[model samples]
Target: MRLRSCLAALALVLLGGAAHAAEECPAKSTSMDDIIAVLNAAPGCDRAMKLFEACEYGASGDVQFGEIVEKKCEADFLGHLKPPQKLSYQRELRVCDRKYRNKSGTIYISFTAFCRAEVAQRYSRRALKAGGAGR
Candidate 1:
């Protein structure tokens, strides 16, 4: 019974350490330009640009600018994900969209900056989750 108790305690400790090792977003903020640089270097720049174009179209008052920007930003993020990662990130993408949905500024620049930050933060977290190696 004592041996079993010790093993159980050890298991919990190991699991707790693993969970702690999973990366969350940094508290230290980054500049919009830095985020943009990261997004430009990421794999989904073309898709992001298309999404940005769609946001621009809607921003011309074809649809609600905020709503379209939010949706397109989420789509751009999801576009970068692999099939397996999509389901995992669905809820997160929605949360990210809602957080930025009502933002107001220059349409192209704002949406680009917003999407860039979102994508950079996602990639940063992913890298940390993979033990500092990016996917």
Candidate 2:
């Protein structure tokens, strides 16, 4: 029951972010920091999260963007959580990693990164929105 409500909250955040993402997605870039910088500006990385999402699906150079975004996004997301939340997130992230652990090279890494970043962003938006209330 609690998990279901959390999932619902996550969905609301992602759906809200998607609309903003569409309008604010940046041009393709070679610099990972460039993308991360933009992502950092968004509480949920909503604007630049699209870039990471699209880049994950891209071949070659695009995968680099996803790799960079995911690492920083994951770190950024975890930075905002408490000790207990971090432990729970690590467990959740392990599940996320397992879902893509089979693929070789950057593809699997980037895919799992995307999955983690997506969840991180959702938590960020919802947590910030509620001012840490009712958690």
- Which candidate's lDDT is highest? 2
Write down the RMSD of all candidates, one decimal each.
13.6, 9.8
Please list all clashing residue pairs in model 2, or write none if there are none.
none
- CA lDDT, every prediction? 0.47, 0.61
> Candidate 1 regions off by >4 Å?
1-84, 107-112, 128-135
Candidate 1's residue-wise lDDT over 14-96, tens digit each? 99998777543221234433333333443543343433333333232322323333443444344556887776665555565
Kindly list the per-residue Cα lDDT of model 2 for residues 1-135, writing each as its tens digit: 999999999999999998676543463464656655555554434544665664344434444554454554554455778899889877776787799667777666666766666666666556556565321
Error of 1 at 130 (Å): 1.9
**What is the C-alpha local distance difference test score of candidate 2?**
0.61
Question: C-alpha displacement of 62 in model 1, angstroms?
Answer: 20
How many backbone clashes can be found in candidate 2?
0
Query: Per-residue lDDT for 105 in model 2?
Result: 72
